[model samples]
Structures are given as structure tokens and as C-alpha cells.
Target: MLWFLTCVAALIGGYFLYGAFIEKVFGIKVDRQTPAHTKTDGVDYVPMSTPKVYLVQLLNIAGVGPIFGPIMGALYGPAAMLWIVLGCVFAGAVHDYFSGMLSVRNGGASVPSITGKYLGNGAKHFMNVFAIVLLLLVGVVFVSAPASMLTNLMNDQFNLGITMTAMVVIIFAYYIIATIVPVDKIIGRFYPLFGGLLIFMSVGLISAIAISSDHSVLGGYEPSQMFTNMNPNDLPLWPALFITIACGAISGFHATQSPLMARCMENEKNGRFVFYGAMIGEGIIALIWCAIALSFFDGMEALQAAVANGGPGNVVYSSAFGLLGTFGGIIAFLGVVILPITSGDTAFRSSRLILAEYFNMEQKTLRNRLLMALPLFVIGGILTQVDFGIIWRYFGFANQTTAVMMLWTATAYLVRHNKLHWITTVPAVFMTSVCITFILNNSQLGFGLPMTLSTITGVVSAVAIAALVIIKSRNSGEVDSEEESLQS
Candidate 1:
């Protein structure tokens, strides 16, 4: 009961507090700034109410990744939960908060556009390629994991022979919705509805579980089970931690979502509410997931067995519902479907925006955007046909790597803009160090260290050099005209 209350309190408290600050400090009047281009149509560029914007942003940002990442991260035991919560605040929330504000101030540009201004054309092109590849990887994995869950549910309930039926249904549903609902309308209504459902289900499940289970319920498991159950090479804390934090801590995907939400902000003040508020809400959700996993699984072996027998989705769902009755299970099952849909919508919309910007094409027509989004849908569908669990692991690794890049970029921006306070530096150094330590320990874990240590070291060194160069350029009064404008 206490745990459940803490989760709710954290969410509510964080939302209002952040909302207040953004309004007070940024004076974020939504109507003061117009979108860069006035090609506004009801489909893609419709304005939204503050409440609706908040809801959609929350749903788009929170997803199955938060639930799963924290659970798997628990392999480092309960201690890791501290990192998840704290990291989100200092590293993740800050990234989202500033990224959104920066985009809005710059006429709703994506991460690449922002990078281009500060990092030069070569870096801009690099970021664009990296962002697209990361998006596809994340999109496919997100779609597949939930589809796999639905497939197992169908097989268990109806003895269906089709292993891929669930995946088909998911893709079909997403396509149908994307075609029918304008991106704006989806964000206005469905996003919040989905977010509300997640909170309700999470609270209900946690409360039910806490009420029913005693301390003795999961005693057979030990803390070391998390590390020992996996190949020693695969279980290194630092590498896994780095990977987990990337997906949960900070994500490039958030960069896409931020600009969309920024366009809807009634005032610049609302940026804090919509951006930072959503992040804090996500962090609370992460904590709840960690609590659930720690409460249910006895050790790593048990978690692995469950995953092997039923897959990760089934293991998570079954455990969540284990403490409750059939009613609880049904609620959890529904939440799983909602999870992927919300994320898919966000990804689809973001991908469309990227394409529009990349090709200098207008997004005035629904047909054109849908045509552009078809490739993403197809790729997600094909990925669903493969081993989802393995795909998810790789996605995790990629997520962390991208986060390091983003944090590096954001840190550079802060330093150049003269906003490099102690708060920023501490979290920046913490996350950067976490990534470096993970890379160093990769050899000891025997995970086949695909990328060489020297190469990783060189990359880190290069980022440091780039940061220095940017600082020197600013000091020497040689900053780019656009970057100077952005800071002012």
C-alpha cells in the first residue's frame, strides 16, 4: 500500500511542480509563437488544449520499455532502482525538458536540425542517419514485443496454431488507425485515454499484489540470481546498466515527440508541463515496474525460466496478474495492447515529420504522410516475424548508445549557451562515466565485445575534443550565426 501510494504521489507531485516552474520561468504562452511554416491543416497541424497535449505527451513517452527495462535492470538487484529513478530526474527529465524548449524556441525543428545549427553539416548528416536507423530499430522491436504477448494470449486462450496472428493484428490495427485518425486528433484524445488506463492498471495491479502477497511469497530466489542466471559475459552490471539507462534514461525518440508537443503548447510556459512533466511521470512508472518485478520474481533463474517457457511478455503479464484474479489479468492484457499502440502512434507521427523535413515536402495531405509511413509499418511487420526477445536485447544496446550521443550533444549545447550549471555537469558526467565504465568492463563479461575498447575510447575522446572545440569557438567569437541566434 505504501509503495502504491508513493508511486501515485510521485507522479502527481512531479506534474504540478514542474508545470508551475515552466509557466513561471519560461512564460510559455502557447499562442505567442507561430509554427515556422503556416501550412496548417486540421490533420497534422491542428492546435490542442493544454490538458490534451499533456495526456498525449505522457502516453507517447511512457510505454512497455519502461516496464521491461526496469524489470530486467533489476538483475542488478533492488539497488539499481535507485539509479533508474535518480537517472531519470537528473539525466532523462533534463534532456526532455531542454530539448523540447530548444525546439519550440527554434520553430519546431527535430534533433538533426538542432544538431546542424551547433555541430556543422557533417555532424548534422551523421545525426540524421543515426536517428533514422535508431527509430526503425526501436519501432520494430516495440511493435514485436507486444505482438508476441498478444500471440501467447491467443494461443493460451484459444489453442490457436498461428504464432504470428497477434503480430498481424497489431500491425493491421495501427495502420487502420493511422489512416482514419488525424495525428492531431489521436494526440488529443487517444493518447491521454491510454495514459490514464496505464496509470489505473498499474495502480490497481500494484495495490492488489501488495494486499495479497506476504514477504514469504517469493523467498526461493536470491539477489545474485539476476547475474548468475545469464552467461557471465552477458550479465556485467555496467554494460547492462548503460543499455538499460539509454532506453529508460534518455531517448532520441523523445526528441521526435517533443517537437510535436511543442507545436501544441498554448504557451511557452506549458513546455515544462508537457515535456518535463511527462518525463517525471515516466520515471514514476519505471519505479512501479521495478517494484512489481522485485516483488514477484524470486531470482534471475526464475525470471529466465518464465521467459524461456512463455517468453518475456507472458512472464511479465502472468506475474503481474498472479496476485490478482481473472479480472486483474484481463486489465493487464488490455494495458499491453494500449502500450504498443500509443508508442506506435508517436513513432509514426515522428517518422512522418522527419520525412517531411528531410525531403522538404509538405505534410498537408493525409494520403502523402500515410504513404510515407507505410515503409515503417512494413518494416515493423517483418521484424515481428523474427525472434522478438533477441531483437529487444539489441534494441536495448542501441538505445543506450544513442542516449550517450544525445547527452553529449545536449551537454555541449549547455556549455556553449552558458547554462552549464553544476546540476547539468553532475548528471552529464555521471551518465557519461556510466557508459565508459560499461565499455571498459565489456571484455571481462565475455560478451564477445563486438566493438573494440580502443575504438570506444577514441569515440569518447572525440566527444571530449568536440566539446572543447565548441567552447573555444564560442570564446573566440566564431560561433555559427544560427547557433548564436538560438542561444539569444
Candidate 2:
């Protein structure tokens, strides 16, 4: 309990202190004309209130990653708390802040465009393809996940006799409409309500956790499980924990989502609140879920076994329904159903925007937006035919790989501007290593090497990448000095 409380407190403090410093480093100013104000296209580039943008951005980056990821992350023990707190403060929020602000500075561009600006056109094209693939996967994963839950919930509680296939078709229809429509029309006006539900669910779960404290709850770190890997699979924490707990910590996927908010923000000052603050908010939610999952089940062994037996979604349903009663049922429905739908819609939308931006295609007209979006959804619909579990296995690595690129791109941006570059550069190296090593260590994914060998190779690869950045920074030239013309 102390650990959980302290982690929460620390995350809050990180917002005002570390979070503010990041905003400062990015040189935010209230008077600058955001792309929303300068380039007002009702479809993709409409101005919105700061608070509203915060919620939309929050809902955009969050999904099952924060919830289920932390649940799985707990398999590595309470050390997941350490990663959530520290990683959220330093890596995740920082990554989000840069991605969002840089997008705003670069004409509200997507990750691939921004990467192209800093990394190069080749890297840009690569990222363009890479990002689209990840988003499609997100679209598919979010679609199947919520649909599966809805089918079960409807059958179990309401006895409505719904099937997973029917649910998928229904939800996929919503994703298509949400993708082609104007942001303010659908996502902007309603995401806050969904965001409110998400916050409410978090609070309810926390209260439930507090009430269940007297049961055979999980205790502090068994000294035996402390530093040596507590992962049930015996994978090292170096990459596995980092990759598993991507949302609360640092994620490349969030960079893709940032441009969505970047196009909607009315002021540069709101960047931290929308991007950095949202990631912190997600970390808290992840921490709460981790604490609950760790305690609600017996020990590590039993928690792992339960997760293996029932799956994360079923566990979420059973545990919440048991703990919070009817309220839990409602919350479970929202968690397992609605939130993922919201995320899927935006994932598809973001992909459309990225491709539209890549082609220098305009999104002012409905026809233009739909023209870009239709084929993507067609591909996504076909992707639904693949087993979702198989799609997710690759999605995780692709997500971290995207993060690695964005971080390096961010470092390059900082260096290009002659600002502090080490902030992103260090984490860039770390996450780069994690992604590379995870593939190398896992046999089906890459070379089936010994864990020790994989770790060394990953670290060496990370260092090489970081060293190249340092050398480039040393040799880099002048900063882009054109500041945004203030409209206010």
C-alpha cells in the first residue's frame, strides 16, 4: 500500500516539477498561433479547448496497453511499479511532450513527416510504412478485443444472444464512420465522456482494491523475487518488462497519436497538459490496476495461473464483477468494450492522416478524407481474418520499434536546435536495445540465442546507435530559428 500510494504521489509531483521543466525545455508560449488556429480545416485541423484536447489525447494514446499490459507486467512482480513511476516521468511523458510539440512546430505533421524532417526522407518513408502497419494492427486488435468482450457480456448478463462476428461487424462499421468524419463531429465531442468513464472506472477499482485489503492480498517484494527476474517465463527484465509495460512507461505508438491532438490544440502551452500529463494519468491508472491484480489474486504463481487460464479480459470481468457488483459489471463493459472501440477509431483515423500527410494530400473535403481512408479500412477488415493473438505478437515489437525511431528523431530535433539532446538520446538507446534484444532472445521472432548473448548484443547495438547520435550532434549545424508568428 505504501508503495502504491508513494508511486501515485510521485507521479503527481512529477507533473508539476519534471513535467513543467519539459514544457520549458520545449519553449512553449501561450501567444503562438497553433495549426488549429492558423489552418482551420473542420475535418482534421479544427481548434478545440485545452481541457477537451487533453481528454481526446488521453483516450487516443490509452487502450488495453495500460490496463492489460500492467496486469501482465505484474507477473514480473512489484518492480512494475518502479518502471511505471520512473519511466512515466522520464521516458514516456518526455517522449509524448516532444512528439506533440514537434508536430505542432512542424505544421501539425504526423510521426513519419516529423521523422522525415529530422531523420531523412528514407527514414521518413520507412516510418510511413511502419506507422501505417502498426495503426492497422491497433485497429484490428482494438476491434476484436472489444467485440469479444461484448459478445460474452451480452450473453452472460443480458442474455442477448450476441455473437463475436456480429459484434465485430457492428464495431467495425463505427470505426469506418469515425475514421472518415470530422474530429469535432465525433471524437472531440464524445471522447471526454468516454474519458470521464475511464477515470470513474479507475476510481472505482481503487476503492475496490482498498476494500479488499484485508484478504490474502499480495505483500511486499519477497526478497527472493526482488532483483533477480520474477518473470514467470524467466525472460530478463531489461527488455521484457520495458516492452510489456509500454504504455505507462514509454511507447512509440503515442507519437502517432500526438499529431491528432497537435492538429486540434489551440495553444502551445497546452502541449504538456495534453501530451505529458496524459501519459502520467495513464501511469496512475496502470499502477492502480497492477496493485489490484497483484493483491486480488493469491500469490505470483496463482496470479500467473489465473491469467493463463482465464485471459486478461475475463480476469478483468470476473474480478471487477466480484469486487464492485453491478457497478463492476458496468465498468467491465466500458473497459472491455467501449474504450477499445474509441481507441480503434482513432487508430484508423491517425493512419489515414499519416498517409494523407505523406502524399501531401489535403483533408479539407469529405471525399478526399474518405478516398484516403477507404482502402486502409478495407485492408484492416481483411486483417481481421487473421488471429488477433498473432497480430498482437508483432504489434508489441513494432510499437517499440516506432518508439525507438521517434526518440532518436526527437534527439536529432533537439540537437538540430542546439538544445539539450541527452534526455531523449539516453532513453532512445535503452528502448532500442529492448526492441532489438526481445526479437533476438525470442526464438520464433528472431535468432534463438542464449539470454546472456541476446542481452549483450542488444546493449551493444543500443550503444552503437547512441554513439552515432552523439557524433552527429557534435557535427550538426545551426538550429531552425523561425519561431511561430503569434496571433494573440
Candidate 3:
């Protein structure tokens, strides 16, 4: 109870502070001339009302990753949940808020373009490669986790391979829709419905779980007990906290969101509503999932057994509805479908943006870009058919690495612009150091020397890029002086 209270307080306090000081005081303006900026052709870059943009942001940000990441983190202990909730407000919200602002200021530039402009062309290319790899990894992990959950639900209810078939069908349908449909139409209608359903289901489940449980409704086992049974091989609390907070903290997906959603903002002031608002909403969802996991199961082993035998959806259903009777079961079933749909649509939009940028298509028509992105989708889907666990592990590392790179870029921007706001810098430094430590601590190559070497390389790269920017600024100033001398 104390832990949960602390987390809630932190989130509430941080949101106000960030909104007042960072977002409102230090205002960022949207650039209109950039290629990716909204030209309002009614297809790709259609203008939207603030309310509509807010709705879209909610749907795009609330994916299965936020739900399950907290659940996994809860397995570490109740304390883990506290860290996640706090981190979401302090670190995650700030990242999303500023990243979107930065992108908008530079005319809907993606992370790569922003890096290129502020950092350099090489850094831009590095960020692009990083973004693509991160996207692929994130897509695969998210797809597999939900697929596994859905499979468990289908098997339990229908006694067939419905889950596997559904996974394939959903992926196929997504690609087909992506190939055919326009971005604005797809997002404008589908996202709001998806987000609405998620809110309804989450509320329904939490209410049902609280009423049905025999023990104290909100109260659960202690944080210490939650950790005692966890797998020793699992990473420690700090690193695990970092991983769990990945999307909510600083997702690579924000790059996609920046360009896709920025055009709709009625004013630059609304960036706070779009970015910070979406992140807090995501954090609340994570908190609910953590509560459900802890309330339902006695320990990690029981939860694992439930998942292994039945699937994650089974665990969620059993935990949520098992005590509530028939109606509860039905609600759980519907929630299963809603969860994946929310995630699937977000993935579709993200992939579309990536393709749009790669091909440099006019924002007016995305048909060609959609066609080009189909092969990549199919390839990812095929890879999903093979070993998923290996893919998940790799994805975890890749996602964290991408976050590190983005944080480095954000840090550079702050340093160069002399905007070293503690809200951004402190979390950025902690995340970077924790990530580097985790990589080094886990590496098995040559008594950890190889991991240390890699960490040093990454650090050097970040510093070198920042140094070059400073030097370039100095040289440009010098050139202006020399030109003035000649003119005079």
C-alpha cells in the first residue's frame, strides 16, 4: 500500500511540474517547411482537431507492451511496480514529451533527421539504422507475446488451434489494410474505438478482480515475497526496472508518432497534451496490470505454471474472472481481442511512417510506401513462426540499445542548446549508466572485458558527436566574423 501510494504521488507531482516548467515555459514551435511537415493534402498529412489528436495519441501509445511489461516487472516484486510508475512520470513522460516537441520543431522530422540536423549526417544515419532495427525487434516481441496469450485463450475456450490461426490472420489482415488503406482514415476511426475498448475492459477487469477476491481487495502479498521466488538468473531490480520501463520510459516508437501525429496539433502548446498525456495514460494502465498480477497469483511459480499450461491469457482470465462467474469470463474473452487490436493498429501506423520516410513519398499518397513495407511485414511474420524466445531476448537488448542512443541524442541537444534541465538530464544519465552496466555485467566474453570495451566505444561515440557539434558551432561563428571583415 505504501509503495503504491508513493508511486501515485510521484506521478501526479511530476506531471504538474513537467507541464508547468518544461512544456509551457520553454515553448517549442513547429517548423512548416520541412519535407515531412504537414501540407494538408487530406491523405497523409491531414489536419486534425486537438481532441482527435489526443484520442489518436492515446491509442497509439497504449499497446500490449505497457500492460505486460509491468506484469513482468511485478514478478520482481511490488517495489518494482513503484519504480515503474515513478519512472513513467519522471523519465518516460519527459522523453515522450520532448521527443515529440523536438520532432515538431524541426518540421515533423523523425529521430534520424533531428539527429542529423543537431548531431550530424553520420549520426542521423546511425539513428535511422538504430530506429529500424529497434522497430523490427519491438514488432516481433510484441506480436509474439500477444499471440502466445491469445493462443492460450483460444485453446482454453474453443479447444482448437484458433490462437495460432488468429495470429496469422491478424498479421495478414494488418498488412492488407496497411497496403490498401490511407493513414488518416485508418487512424481517425480505428484508434479511438480501440482505445475506448481498452479503457472499458481494463476498468471492468480491475473492478471484477477487486470484488471477487476473498482477501483485502487492493492489498496483496509483500514485495519481499514477490521477489523470493523469482528466477535468480533474471536481471537485478535496477536493470529490470530499466527494461520494464522501456516503452513507457522512452520508446523508439515515439519517432514514428512524432511525424505521424505532429501535423495535427492545433498549436505547439498542445504537444503536452499529445505526448505527456499519452504517457501518463500508459502508466495508469501499467499500474492496473501490476495490481491484477499481484492480486491474482500467490507467487511467480504459480503464474508461470498457469501460463505454461494454459497461456498468459488464461492467467489473466483466471485471475480476473475465475471468481466472478460466467459474465466475468465473457468480459475477459472480449478483453483478449481488444488488447491485441490496440497493439496491432499502432504497429501498422508505425510501419507506414517508416516506409513513407524511406521512400520520400509525397505526404499526399502513401500507396507506394505501403506496398513497399509489405515485404518487411511478411518477413517479420515469418520470423515470428520460428523460435520466439531467442527473438525476445535479442529484442530486449536491441530495444534498450535504441533507448540509449536516443538518450544520447537528447543529451547532446540539451548540452548544445545549453538547456541542461535536470528533469531530462538526470533520468537520461541514470538510464544510460544502468544500460551500460547491465550489458557489461551480463556479457560472458573474456571475463567481461569485451562488454567493457563495447561500453567504452558507445560512450566515446556519444562524446565525439557532441564535441564535433561544439566545434562546428565555433567554426561557423568564426566564418561569420571573417565574412564581416571582408565586407567592411
Q: Candidate 2: deviation at residue 189, Å?
A: 0.8
Q: What is the C-alpha lDDT of each candidate?
A: 0.62, 0.83, 0.61
For model 3, residues 234-272, the per-residue Cα lDDT tens digits are 655655566655554555565556556765665676777
Model 2: CA > 4 A from native: 213-228, 479-488
lDDT of 2 by residue, 1-488 (tens): 66788889999999999998878776786887888988887888899999999999988888888877889888888888889999899889999999899888877888997887677788899999999999998899898888887887779888999988999999989998999988999999998888878877888777777767554234545645544567777766777788888877887889999989998999888888999999999899889878877878777787788788856786677667877787676774575466678889999999989888777788888888889899998999999999877887888888889989999988887887777888888889888888888999888777878878888999999999888876675576543443632111
Clashing residue pairs in candidate 1 (N, C-alpha, C atoms within 3 angstroms): 28-267, 28-268, 28-269, 29-267, 29-268, 30-266, 30-267, 221-298, 233-445
Better of 1 and 3 by lDDT: 1
Residue pairs with backbone overlap in model 3: none
The C-alpha RMSD of each candidate to the native structure, in angstroms, is 4.6, 2.4, 5.3
Question: What's the C-alpha lDDT at position 360 in model 1?
Answer: 71
Of 2 and 3, the candidate ahead on TM-score is 2
Per-residue lDDT tens digits of candidate 1, residues 1-488?
A: 34335545655565576445433443444555534233246665556777888778877766677777777665555555556655666567767876677676666777777766655677678777776766666667666666667776667665786566656675657644663367665557666677667877777766765666452222434555423423223665644564664445565567667777766665666677678878877777776666666667665666656656765475577765676556767666677567766776677667767766777766677677767777766776677667766676666655555555555555555556555433444555555555565555455432444445634663576557556645653663425432233323
Clashes of each: 9, 0, 0
Count of backbone collisions in candidate 1: 9
> Residue 373's C-alpha lDDT in candidate 1?
74
